[model samples]
Target: MTILKNRLFWPAAILVALLIVNAFTSNQFVTVRDGHLFGSLIDILRGSAPLVLVALGMTLVIATGGIDLSVGSVMAISGAVACLLISDLGNQNSVGSVLLIIVIAIAVSLLAGLWNGALVALVGIQPIIATLILMVAGRGIAQLITDGQIINVQSGPYATIATGFFLALPVAFLIAVAAVVLITLLTRRTALGLLLESVGGSPTASRLAGIRSRRITTMVYVVSGGFAGLAGLIYSANIKSADSISAGNLIELDAILAVVIGGTALIGGRFSIAGTVLGAVLIQALGVTVVAVGVPPEATLLFKAVVVVALCLSQSAAFREKVFGRFTSTRTEAIA
Candidate 1:
């Protein structure tokens, strides 16, 4: 009963059901080849890695009663910077140089994050409005970096960041997992999580309690940017090019959905890292399952939304009680 009551129960059940359906479509869906785990499941993990990073960051920002609409733009900017720099590298294959380029790209993303933080925390602007500015301008900035062209690069070391496997698993998946562990430790194993929840619950109350809410809020935005930057690199690496215009397009919406499905309320306060990870995977699984089942492209989103809505409804205790309470009452009346 306790396990059924858990918020993650429905989401997990839905994911398992999807996989079971996928297994019926093709035995290869869940099969491992030659002692190596290579299947649709693995592909979902690899493809969802970018969203996992973005959603993790989104979880942090939303936990502070804030939102980051600029993460998608940050992703674009980060990819543009990395690919533009990599394309100029004389060797284009030096592992060290690619690493440095990755660092610089992330640095730019940090600055973009700082910009959002400053606007929201320092200027007292609404989080949505503040981040929206960057959500619009950041794309232009990316375009400027790539001069409106898709910059392509050929770097074996860089390409491997997304495609390579370690221990028979994708490097991207491993990176996403590492990020989850790192953030879990950062927020849960320390006072930071409490502080963030406090601020999210009520900033004014947190201030009265002597917590530096502004600093915490600003810091989360910065972290969100950093994560988006990392995701950008992985995305560009997977494609071997940086598309300033199309990169990270509409990704912010997906990240927000992932966080919400993970049981993090949009109004803020309280978060679940593990749940977010599961939600990200579920989102990816839904996409793969829909395609595999041969759903029409035009109706794919509608079908997905219906499924997600059902899952969300399943998590609502009040809704369940309301719908089932009358039946139980009827039975009691008969007994009486």
Candidate 2:
């Protein structure tokens, strides 16, 4: 009974509720045909890949009591860099060019991250203020790379990163899964996860305990930026164009919202990559539902915002305590 009433139970229940609603409202919501799933089900996972990747990164940053407002812009920069390289090379089939471009893109993103980390970690700048500089400047760099115009590159290998699939699931989804797994191993399998949470939960205590909190904080942002860069490449590959103006616009909001909805406290400490993935899928599903039902496309954004608000409210401290407090068992209470 105590386990059933744990704080995470309600969020899990709400996730199931959304899934049930989706199934009932759309005839094709859960259909599996010819070894492929279609309708809202496919749309959710497909749309969520970038968000999942970004959210995984966000979880780490938030865990260290920092935020990377520049992720979306970094994504744009990464995409622009990748597309320009492919366009300059004149073909995606040029394996040498492809490899070189990816390396350059990753390097650029890491450099941006290093700058952010230096500002926050060494110069003692506030996370918001430091990243805000790049958030504004990064997009300008992306536009400059594209010569202030969208660049289109039609390449099978490039498009395959986004639009292609393996074993009927999206390649993007697979990549997101792999990223989550790797990060989980890095944090959970090592001492890093606990140390990060310790730092976030109480920085002074962690520092007194001999944790190198500053270094960990810096690393979080760099990893976050790298993930954002990867998302940019996937997104650009999907669309086959690098649109500086619109690619990844407001995606930071989506990622932060997903992180919050995943039951990860925005104030920092605990992180859950699996929960973030679920939250990403749920938001994406809501968008698909709005579209498949013939509602105005613009309304989808508004609905997504509403979902975020509701999820946040339900996952708030007061709600969790009130709804889940009563089922505590004597044995568990004693253990606590």
Candidate 3:
């Protein structure tokens, strides 16, 4: 009963509901091709990678009671950086070329993150306003890198970063797993998670306790931006082209939604990486359900909005305490 009462329950319920619906609605959805779940399941995971990655970062940020609204822009910046660097290689040195491009992409992403950290931690700017600066300017930087045009690259290794397969799983899935594992290890295995929660629970108290809440808060944003940058690389690699306008449009919103739906309170102090991943999968599955049912993509966003509203409502304290409480009491009586 307690497990069901936990905040994670709502997302788990929705995820299961979607799976049941998908199983009945689409023949191909349950079908497995080779060793992988084909059709909508694959589509769900494929479309989910970028959102999952961003949400992973957002999980930590929200844990610190901060938000990063500039993730989409960071994605744009990183994609443009990778495309430009790879394009410049032009068959220069093969292994060295690939290493250089990947290294530059990681470096640029970290730098972008550091920029966000500095402004928020050192300058004492509001998180939203500070990231908004990058949110607006980051795409322009991407445009400058590509000269305001879509950059097309025909690199095999680069393309594989997005489209490649390893051990019958998508590379993006592996990356998402690695990120979650690392973060889980960091937070659960060390005092950092404890400090983050302490900070989010009450910044002043944490500061009084000698916790560098400001630095932790800023570090979350940097991590968020860096992950967004990595997501951008995966996205562009999947498509083999970089279009500034379409690369990461409105992705920040999706990532935020995922974090919210994952049982993370937007007000902060709590984080659930597993729940967030489940939420991302559910959101992507919702899109697949819309498409599988022959609904127009135009109406899809509206449906998603409705689902999101319901999910958020279910997360409210009143609703959870009421509905879940009643259900639990009823079950207890029956058992007695």
Specify the highest-lDDT model's number: 1
Cα shift from native, residue 272, model 1 (Å): 1.1
lDDT of model 1 at position 140? 98
RMSD of each: 1.6, 4.7, 3.1
Backbone Cα, N, C clashes tallied per candidate = 0, 0, 0
lDDT of each: 0.93, 0.82, 0.82
- Please, what are the lDDT tens digits per residue for candidate 3 over residues 1-336? 667657778778887788777777787764555775556666677778888989998888888877888888888888898888887775833766876787788678878888888888789887788888988998898899899998888888887767666877777877878888998899989998889888888888999999998889878887887889889999988888778878788888888888887777788787778888888888888877777777777888898788888888777889877887899999999999
TM-scores of the models, in the order given: 0.96, 0.88, 0.91
Report the C-alpha lDDT of model 2 over 113-153, residue by residue, as the tens digit: 88888898889999999999999999999999999999998
Which pairs of residues clash in candidate 3, taking residues 3 or more apart in a chain or in different chains?
A: none
What shift in Å separates residue 159 of candidate 3 from its native position after superposition? 1.3
Q: Candidate 2 — which pairs collide?
A: none
Backbone clash total, candidate 2: 0
Candidate 2, overall lDDT? 0.82
Error of 3 at 199 (Å): 1.6
